[model samples]
Structure formats: structure tokens, C-alpha cells
Target: MRVGSTMLVRQNLTRKLSRSILLVICIGIAFFVFGVLSSFRAGFEGSEANSERLVVASKIGGNETLPLRYFQQLGGMDEIAEVTHVTRLRAHTAGNERNIIGANAVDAQSYASVYADTYDFNAEIMQAFQADRTATLVGRQLAEREGWAVGDRVNLTSFVHMTQDASRDWSFVIAGLLDGAEPTVDTNFLIVRYDYFNAALLRNQDQVNLFGIKPAVGTDINVLAETIDMTFANSTAQTRTQSETAFMSAFLEQFADVALIVKLIVSVSFGTILLIVANTMIFAIRERTLEIGVLKVLGFSGSSIMRIILTETLVLFAAGLALGFALTAAVIPVLGDALSSVVPDLYLTPKVVATSVGLAVVFAVLTGFLPAIKALRLPVATALNHR
Candidate 1:
């Protein structure tokens, strides 16, 4: 009996090929949006869970530099395990659409240790980074994009120049490539020795964009962050300190509420999809009124008719989800390198796929439900005579 009902469902679907295809396209696009948005939100969320890391920056904003003296003041504190500072510099490569990333002038010896969780630097690379003032360590993504290798010389344009007429161009040899510990690390930037940058940029001397601190184990990170911020509150350059993850979150927030925006988009897409699929199902049920009446006359129960309709809707949803997932997979390899900064480790995880499929099933049931019930409630005699 179930096999016979399944055959009827398949026949009905084959008769309405265009409508099924449209419904599949709608659901697939919705799932595609959901998958991409969820991936980006995951990156921001995971960064917040690391316990020992904190970022100290100016109270004014990220662009405002803190006095270099705070580096020593924070380093001397008993609660801190390690402290490192970085100054931001604008960097440009030769390509027209080059993803111009913000480079960092870091204290070479200790910078690697600050982000030990996200990057691994070798002894030779660290030594070279420290010894040569002209040495720059490039991230793997940037290196691949620019086709740069160790010992390769490249010229970069820095926007921070003392004089308007002075040259913005600075040259450096690629000392090493940064090995990213995770995908979320914004490895699209270059790292130059702070001392080199300080001497070179005349006006921005003795200042850093932010400081990274590692607290001692067992210390209350919240309390420590508050203490650091308070200590510098009365100073010439006041500080605002927070967990490293919070800092990244705030940094991303400056652009916009990306997750919320994505959620809103997905919501709207799904809402419209619900209407379209429900309408399609209603029209399909009406067209098969006579067929449904015949089925009832043949001793098939009303519940069986409902199940057949629900199954057909679910099949359409499943087909759409499959196509959507395939599209996502194809686009990732092309866009992954560019979007790695925002949506790190973008791929079709089992969790995302399952969530998408589950959402589709729920949508299908909802869309098919009323129509199924209506089909069942129809009087066999009336339905057969009318159509």
C-alpha cells in the first residue's frame, strides 16, 4: 500500500516538473544564505572562548595610538604572563584589486609568543625577524596571492608618511612566512619590526595601535582587564582593555552587525519561500481533487493521502537542499581565500548541512500540512462530481 502511494506521489511530482523545479530553487537559495552566514558567525564566536588573552587599546578608538611607555608599565605588572604591542600600517601591493591589508609593526621577539595560540614561528624566522630591520614576515595567504617567497624583495606603499611629498614606498625582504595555527587568524597582513617602523615613520614614533597581553593562569581575566584599563585611565593616553575575542568582535562590529544582517536576509528569503511553496502545494492539491476522490473510493485512508502529500513536499525540499549544498561547495574553493578573513575555515560541515536539511523538512511539513488536511476532509462524492 505504501509502495502504491509512493508511486502516486512520484507521478504527481513528474506531472508538475516546472513547479517542483521552482520550489527547489527557492529552498536551495535560502539554505545557501543560511550556511554562509552561520560559518561567519562561528569565526567570531570561537575567538571569544580563549581565556588567557586580552587586548589593550586606546579608549578613543582602534585607530588612535597608545603611548609606547605603557608597554613597559604593563609588562612589569605581577598578574601578566606576557605583553606585546603592535602598530598598524596601511599596505598596498601591485595588483589593481589587491586586498590591501593592514600590516602590523610588532616587537619581533615577543609578538609570536603573544599569539602562540594562533601562529607558530620557528627559531630561524624569529632570529631573522629580530636581526634585520628590513625583514618582513608575510602571512601564507598574502604570500600565495602575491607569489612571494623567502628572500624575495618587494616594495610596499605605506600611507603613514611624515611629509606629503616624501616617498611612501618602503622595501623589505620576506624573511619568513607565518604558519597560521587556525583559519581565523587574519594572516593576510605583513609583520615588520617595530623598531624599523618607528625610525622610518617620523610622526608616529613611540606609539602603538594596541597591546596584547597574556594573563597568568587562574587570574580572573575580567578583573585583570579592568585593572589595566584603570591604571592608564589618568594617563595622557587612556586605555580600554578587554578580552582578545571581545576586541575582535568590537572590531568587526565597527563595520556592521554582520550576523544579524545575514539572519534578517535568511529570514526574509525563507518567509517568501514558505508562501511560494504553500501556494504551489495548494494549486497542486486542487488540480488532483478528482484523483484524491478516486483514492478515497479505492479504500485508501485519509491519513494515507496526507502522508503522500507530505512526502512529496519533503522530496522537493530535499532536492533543493542538495542543490544548494553543492553550489556552496563549488563557490567555497574560489572565494575561501578572499573571505578567510571574515568566514574562516568556510566549508560544508555536517552540522550546517544537517541544520539546513532539518529546516527544509520543517518548512515542507508546514507548507504541505493545510493542503494535506483539506485534501483528506473533502467528501469523496462531492470531489468526484465537481472535478
Candidate 2:
């Protein structure tokens, strides 16, 4: 298009400044939501999909405890390099109901071996933890939140388990502060010795909620996951084994279908903005029929009319898309802090940016085509009749 025509298009877009700004804000909200949700998915999927470790749980449900013997059976497999088991229970200080948190009863040695790459607690902490039957290691976040310190003797009430004393209360000395290597890695939980937990239980003795396993180097994780499940397929306690991340995803899914919710919100937002921008432009074109007639009379071709209309639409989308993504980038860190318990590394990613840009282009074409075609096909006399 000529410089004169470019100037005309800009004038037409800004003819009603308020409408243009409103449409741009509508589009911006859509893309901002899309960008944020895409980052959330990328954060979870990127970190969890390629992990080599596996989890084995009862077919009934991961929360249901399986025989502790499954731990030994998994460890004996040639494809498995290490194994550990844990059962979790919700706990709070005896007098503090609002402070309720979950604690894991774990085998320290086997757990450290299996999870060395994932967990980053102090080595010295384990010595004190192993030496005391009722010792607990408090995660840094949990300790700070609850005002706990090493050597502090605390009594906790378990919501799920009962002790041989016919009560839910358990006693522990805080052996040390457990910590994670990364700021986003969750260090807001508790860990206790499996032996102490088991010996004190009133029922469901010799059981674990799930087992963690590491595949031997070069062993295919999928093959090992299937083999582990098949071994117990016909047993009294059948197993369902999958990647560690898959298990966590399944657990999170119980609380809410996060992926589905994010997708639904984004889809609705994009669909709403597409229709809004299309209808608004349609009316704007109808109102400008006389001006289009004047332009055609001045020797502007149908192709030029089409180009100018489409260019106007592209400009609006360009502004909106840039503003939306800018907000997404600015808000990602803040959202990550809020959701740190769930998504560890939420942020704008290159893949999400590329995808959003591509989607916006397609949406712009679809939204603009009808109005532009209406202008392109308008005969000079017919458009002039509007005068």
C-alpha cells in the first residue's frame, strides 16, 4: 500500500479512539490468559515428563497402603537400581488445627538413594534422624511457618493414623531442618522414620502407601513400569506403576483437573474476543461505506481497499498481543510465588511465545476477512448511496 493509503488506514482505526482501545483490551485479556496458562503447563510438563524414576501403588488407589513386601520385590528386579517406600499422614501440633500438614514416614537410607537427585537435605541431619526412633526432619518452609527448631520436642496429632496407645498423638524431637536445592522446589513438608511410624501403628501394620524405584541405567522406564505392574497383576494386592511425575499428576488431579480448567478458560476467552472484534469491525465498516465510496472514486483498487482493511485489523491485534504478553511476563513470577506449592517453575517460555504469536495471526485473519471483503466488493455507486 502507498504511504497515503497507510495514513488513511491509521486515521480510520483511530476515528473512535475509545472503541479501538476497548477492542485492544479485550484481545489483550485473551492473550494474557493464554500466555499464563501455557507457562503453567510448560513448567509442569517439562520437568516431569522425562524423569526416569517410577512409583508403584496399589491398583485400588495410590492412597491405599500396599504390603511392605512390594518394596523388596521391586528392589530385586534387575531393571530396578534402588527402592524406597513411604506412607503419608496429615499432622498438626496437638493444639493447632489450622496448622495441619502432611508428613511422610520414610526409610531414610533407601529414600536417600532413590531420591538423591530430587531432594537436597543435609547429610548430617540423617545421622541424628536415624539414631532416634521418634525423630522428625522438618522442611525449611514448614519449620519457619510453624516456628520449629532442632531439639524442640513436639507432640503431633495424626488425622489418618491411630497409635497403639489408642490415640492419634505421636511424639518427636525435631532432629534437623530439611531443605531443597531450588527456591521453587517444595520444601514445605515433613518426614519421619518409617520404623517408628510402623511400630506405633494400631492397625495396617507392615504396609506402605507407595514405593519409589529408580531404573537401572540404560533400562527403558516404560518397560520397567509395565514389568513391575505385571508382576503383581494377579496377586492379592495388584499394583499400578508409572513415572514419578505421572503419580504426582494423578494425585493433583484428585484435587482439581488443572489442565482441563486452564484450557477451558483460554478457549472461552479466545472465542469471546474473536467474535467481539469481528462484530465491532463489521459495524465500523458499515458506518464508513461513504468514505470507502469516496476512496474508490479517487482511483483506489479493490485490492488496495482489502489491504487497508486487513492492515487496520492487524494493527489492532499487534497492539493487543504485545500488551497481553507483557502483562503475562510481569505477572508470572508473582503467580509462581502463589502456586509454588504446586507448579515449581512457572514462567513465560519461548515455546509459549511462538505458539501465542502464531495463534494471534490466524485469529486476526479470520476476524478481519469478512469486513475487508465487504469493503473490497462494494461498488462505488452502491457505497456512494450511503451518502
Candidate 3:
């Protein structure tokens, strides 16, 4: 019975090639957009999955700078495993004023120890960085995008903190390329030696932009965070400490309401798919009214007729969805370089693909339900009496 129904659907589609192709195209586009958008949202949220790390920043706000001495205090706690400081330096590459890079001065050893899983740091690279005061480690994606390599000199012009002469004084040699082990460690960042930046701005000795902290095993992160904050309560630079996940979430919140935006986009995309499939089903049922009546007259039960129609709709939607997902999976990796800066770690994981396909199937089933019911309810006698 199922085989017959499948054959019937194929015949119907083959007979009306243009309409079938149009339907497939519409469904394919909707699925493609759905898959891409869903993956992007997932990527955004996945940026903060590290369990053992935390970030300490100025209590005033995200942009406020914290004191470098705060790290020394945090490091003194038995509950704290390690502490590293980072300072944001918004700068452009040398000679090319148009080319911009998001660079940060970081304590490399501490950073590597904390995020060893996300960053593959070798002994040679660490030794080179430690030995050369002017050395910098660039993200793999950034290096590829900018055509940089080891031993290459790149000067950065600071936008936030400029020199009195209006000349960019910051420069570093690319010692190694840093590749993120996961999607969360933003691949567009350049990690330079924090000591270099500190030495350069000795007059501004107290300022450190952010501190990355790793908690000791079995320590309660919340309790330790509170303890660190209380220790700095009377300080000139107040502190705010949170888990690494919360740190990334805080940054994301500054841009937009991520949850609301993701919900809106998914809702709109699903609605568009519903309308497209529903409209296509309506037209298909209208055109096949006489055929449906013939089947009804030939002893096809209402339930059987409904099943056939639903099956056809499922086949069409499935084909389109499969095509779109395959295309997305193939294209996303190839365009990694172009999209890395904008949608860092944009790749179609298995979970993302499965969820997208499931969404398409659900929408297809819902949209086809009405048309299937309409076909099933057609009276044999009445349909036969019509032209």
C-alpha cells in the first residue's frame, strides 16, 4: 500500500514538473535561511561554554578598566588556581589605515593555562613569545585574513589610547598563530604580551582592562567571585567577577537582546515557510480535485486519501530540506575565512542540521494537514457530478 502511494506521488509530481520544481525551490530557500540563522544563534550562545574559568572586570561597566594589582590579590586566594590580565587595544595595521584588528595585551602563560583546551599552545611557541619582548600571537583566522606570518612586523595604531604625537607607537612581531579548539574562543583576537603594554604605559600603572581567573578544583565559583569583589570593595578600582560564560554573555548583551532576536528571527522564518508550503498545498489540491474524486469513486477510503496527500507533501518538503541542508553544510566551511570575523566559529554541526530538518518536517506536516483533510472530505457522487 505504501509503495503504491509513493508511486502515485511520483507520477503526480512528474506530470506537473513546473509546479513541483517551484514548490521545491520555495521550500529549499526557506530551509536554507532557517538552517543558517539557527546555526548562527547557536554559535552565539555556544561562545561561553567553558566551565572552569571566570572574568574579573571593573565594577563600573564593561568599558571601565580594572587595576593590575587586582590580579595579585585574586592570585593570593587558595580558591583561585591562576589569574591573567588583558587590556583591549583597538588598533589598525601599519601603513594600511583602513585595515583594523581587535588586539589585546595578555598574560600568555596564565591565559594558556586557563584556556589550554581552546588554544593549542606548544613549548616552542611559548618559549619564543617569552623570549622576544616584542612578540605577539595572532589568531589563526586573523593571520589568514591579514596575510601575516611568523617574524612579520605589524604596527598597530590605537584608537582608544593615542600618543601625544598622533603616531602609532605599538608594534609587535607575529611569533605564532593561535587556533581555537572550540567555537567560543573568538578567533579574530590578537594576543600580545601584557608586560609590553604595561612597560609602555608605566605612568598609568594601576589600569588593567580585564582579568581572567581560573578557580581551584571543587571551589564554589559564586562564593569565590563574591570574595574577590569584597576584597576590592574599598579599592580605587572596584571589581566585578563572574564565570567565563557570564563574562561572554555580558559582552553579548551589550550588542542586542540575543534571546529575543533569535526568537523573532525563528518565528518569522517558520511563518514564511508555513505560508509557502500551505499555499503550494492549496494550489496542488485545487488542481487535483477531479483526480481526488476519481480515487474516492474507486474505493479509496477517506483516511487513505488523506494519507496519500500528506505523503506527497512530506516527500516534496523533505527533498527540498535535504538539498538545502547539504548545500549549507558544504558552503559554510568553504566560506569560513569570509565569515569568521562576523560570525566566528560558524559551522553546521550535526545537532544544528538535525534540528533544522526536524523544523522543516514539522512545518510541512502542519501545512499539509488542511489540504489533506479537504481532499479526504470530497464526496464521490458530488465530485463525479462536477465538470
Candidate 4:
């Protein structure tokens, strides 16, 4: 057979078809795990774009309320500008005891302006909502869940807030639906007007659960957060302020360093597979020792033998990675839909694809190098006289 013939490589692979297929399956499983884990880590990391903003909550506890007057103190500071606050309410619709809603009472202008990049809002619809105090912006997912539409009047019963008459009942007009700019964003809640909700409440009327802050154009967020916290350091309503990214990172870290865990898992899997692949290549080339000697006698160079062995390894890697990534692409969207709350936007990213491809090339070289070298160094007389 011609030394450089494609038939030579094909024959070598098919001579042990089941072993080759098994190796490919092993590689495919590794890449699939890597892709899924990488995407999972990305989803848990949350949006990095909103890192510039800050969230200031009461230092007393995670769910403790903050005084509404803190907004004025925070907004008047040089570093802090355009402060927005949220008064959270836990509520469910009348007659439907099953679905609970995480609702917030916010000022329309400040809230929308602060979260402009996070949410997709219509100008006309916001204007209508602003014009009516009873209007609420229901998240698209929540709206769909409750089968609600624009202009639909929703009677809500609050679990926290009570009316002046000691009733938990409140009503709202569905002014519009909320949409997210990011697919991973959880749009399963609603927001009502602060003025209207506070006025109706019998207790804790002038309190806010969270504060959203925009720093001055050139201000450092860490410095800004420090300044804000220090301003109320000696006061009754002390605060814990952090950048949006820091807040999310802290929340995720409460469980574990998930990204690190993913890396460790992938590393172990790839290491095990690497040894398997390299060992298999060595044995396969050893089996072709006598054939290689015949090829040399037929005038084929050692360089040509090297190319054949390396090329076969690459072919195995290419087929395996292709299958693995294709499976990953198919599985991600289904996972995103099923576990939206746990892992949102679970699709493969360009960085991940590039990383996977780069790693594959390096690993393929590592697997093929020793075997290819042995083939290249095998003297024609020695190979021919061998068993």
C-alpha cells in the first residue's frame, strides 16, 4: 500500500472498529461535561454588565428594612447619584393560594432609569403606568403564569403589608408587562408604585427593603460603597452596600466556589481520558511495527510514518469533539427551560468553544507525540526483523 494513502489510515482504524468507536465515545462524554459545566458556571455568575450599580440594604439582617429617608442622605452625596429604592411585598392574587409573587413598590422614573439596561420597557406604557398610581408592571413570565393582560385589574393580597382597615387586600391595574434584556434574568415578579402602596399600609409606611444606586461617572464603586456605609455608620439604620456584581458573587459564594469545582471535575475527567487515548495509540502503533518496516522497504520515509500516526489521532479527536459539542448544543436550551430559576442562559459561549478547541488540539498532540516519535525512530531493519 502507498505510505501516504488515506486508505492506510482508514484500514488502521477499521481493523479495530469497536475500540476506535469506544475511544470516540469516551472523548465525546468529556467534552459534553466540560461544555455543560462551563455554561452552568457562567449562568451562576450572573450579569457582569450591571456591575457599576450598587445595592444598599440594611446591615441588621438580609431581610431587614431600611428607612426611606436614607435615600435623601445617599442621593445628596457627591459619589452617590440618582438613588432608587424598593419596598418589597410578598403577595398572591385573590382566590389563587398556590402562586406567590415577589412584588416591589418603586418610583417609576427612578426605577426605570436605574435599571434601563436590565429591563425592556415601552415609553408609552410607562407613561400610562406613571399616570396611574394603582398601575403595576408584571414580569412577562409572571403575567403569562397568571394569564393576565394589559388593562386587566388584579386584586392582590399582601402577606406583609396591611391596609389601614387591617386588611391585607390591595388592587392594581396591569399597566404593562416586563421583559428582560438578558435571557438569564428572572422576570417572574412584579413592581407597583411606592406612593400608592405606602399610603395604603397601616405599619412600616416609610421603609424600603433595598436601595439601588448609580455612582458619579468617574467614582470608584468600592469607595462609593464605603462612603455611603460610613455616612450612616453611627445611625439606627446602618447599611451594607456593595456593587451589583459583588452582591451576586457573595450570594453565589455562600454555597461554594462552583467555578473551581467545575474546573477540578473537568481536569480529572480529561486526565483520565488522556492516559487512555495515549496508551491506545501506543499499542495500535506497536501492532503496525512490521507493516511500517515493509513501508520503509517500499521507499516511505520515517517522516511519512510520523504524519500517518499523528493524523489518525487528530481524526479521532475531531470526530469525538464534534459529536460532544453537538450534543452539548442540543442539551443546553432544554436545561435552561427546565431549570430556569437554578441555571438560566445555559448556552455555550464563544470563549468556551474556543477554549474547548484549543484544549483538544493540545491534548491530541500530547496523545500522538510519543507513538509518532516511536514510529519515526524505528529503524527499517529492526522493524522488519521484529516479531
Best by lDDT: 2
lDDT of 1 at 372: 98
- Please give the CA lDDT of all the candidate structures: 0.81, 0.85, 0.78, 0.85
Range of the 10 consecutive residues with the lowest summed lDDT in candidate 3:
160-169
Pick by lDDT: 1 or 3, better one:
1
For candidate 1, list the clashing residue pairs, or say none: none
Candidate closest to the true structure, highest TM-score:
3
Q: Which candidate model has the greater lDDT, 1 or 2?
A: 2
Model 3, CA-based lDDT:
0.78
lDDT of 4 by residue, 1-387 (tens): 255477778888888999999999988888999888888887777643378999998887547899999888887888866789998787777767555676899988888878887888779769888989999998887787678999999888888789899999889999999889776566777899999999989999899988999888999999888888898899998999988877766657768988779989999999999999999999999999999999899987888878888878888888889988998999998887776656544678877788889888888889999999999999999999978
Better of 3 and 4 by lDDT: 4
Clashing pairs in 2: none
Candidate 4 global Cα RMSD: 3.9
lDDT of 2 by residue, 51-78 (tens): 6788888889867879999888888899
Model 1 per-residue lDDT tens digits across residues 1-387 = 377678988998989788788888888888877776665565544442354699999999987999999999999998998899998876665343255655788998668887777787888888878778999998886787678899998677766644233667667889999877866455666898888878877576898999999898788999999899899889889999988777876777788877678779888989998998999899999999998999899988899999999999899889988888887887766666667555545555667778887898899999999899999899999889965
What is the C-alpha local distance difference test score of candidate 2?
Answer: 0.85
Error of 4 at 103 (Å): 3.3
The sequence of per-residue lDDT tens digits that candidate 3 reaches over residues 1-387 is 467777777877777888788888777777777677766765665553565688888898888898777778778899988878888877887666666787988888888887787787888788888888889998887887888899999788876655444455688898988877764466776888888776776255557788888889899999998998999899888988888777776777789867678778778876887887788788878877888889887888888888887888888888889887877777777665566655666777678778877877788789889998888788877767666
Give the Cα-based TM-score of candidate 4 against the true structure: 0.80
TM-score of each: 0.83, 0.81, 0.85, 0.80
